[model samples]
Target: MEDYLEKIYELMHEKGYARVSDIASSLDVQPSSVTKMLQKLDENHYVTYEKYRGILLTARGQRLGKLMKERHHMLEEFLRMLGVSEETIHKDVEGIEHHVSPHTLQCLQALVLFFDDHPESLNDLHAYTEQFEMGSPTDTEGKSV
Candidate 1:
């Protein structure tokens, strides 16, 4: 449902409208599925749905969708700033945005903005991670310290 809201909000801005087919294609689902979800969203007061007409989000729906999109965009930018591979970044962001709390997301957004402003700090972090990539030094008994 969040995914549908996010995509619809995105398409609304990008294309000035969203259709069941467009959402189905974007989500890789069938139009029938999109229709069902849209009805649910409508019932929940998140969207105004009328068959063969257009869908428009209510205030609450718009807020939630905008938040979802921002969270997704922020995670992607944060992962990219950390030098994450493009292939790995998208999946990671999707997995993360759904699970992370609003507070944690804010923290991550702060970190991303900080790194963007102070790229030298990000370079330092990359340099620091190199040690872990090679292998963490273990203490006695083969335990990592």
Candidate 2:
């Protein structure tokens, strides 16, 4: 449901409306599958769906979609900071976004803000990572030797 809402939100932003075929293509699913989901969403009041017409998100759906998009962006940024490859960031964010708890997400959000506010810290971490990868010795306390 969240995925559907998120895709619909993206389509609406990019194309001004979300047709069932558009959602199907975006999600790489069949139009029949999208229609079934849209029917469910309409029943749940998440979307206003009409046959042969585009869908409109309800307020509740819109809020959830915005939140899901933001969460995905935050996770992608954090993964990039960790030197994850672009493909991996995209794949991992999708898998991780749905599973993250509120508390964990808050921590990740803080980490992102910290890195943004203190770029020197990110640089230091990267430098430390390079040294560790090069077989630099470290003490029991994890400081470089």
Off by over 4 Å in 2: 136-145
Residue pairs that clash (backbone atoms under 3 angstroms), model 1: none
TM-score each candidate: 0.88, 0.90
lDDT of 1 by residue, 83-132 (tens): 79999998898789889898999999999999989999998788767756
**Model 1 TM-score, 2 decimals:** 0.88
Using lDDT, give the best candidate's number.
Answer: 1
Segments of candidate 1 deviating more than 4 angstroms: 137-145
Residue-level lDDT tens digits of model 2 in 1-145: 8889999988888988888888898888999999999999999988999988779999988888888888889999999998888978988998998898989999999999999999999998887777788898576698868
Every candidate's lDDT? 0.91, 0.89
Clashes of each: 0, 0
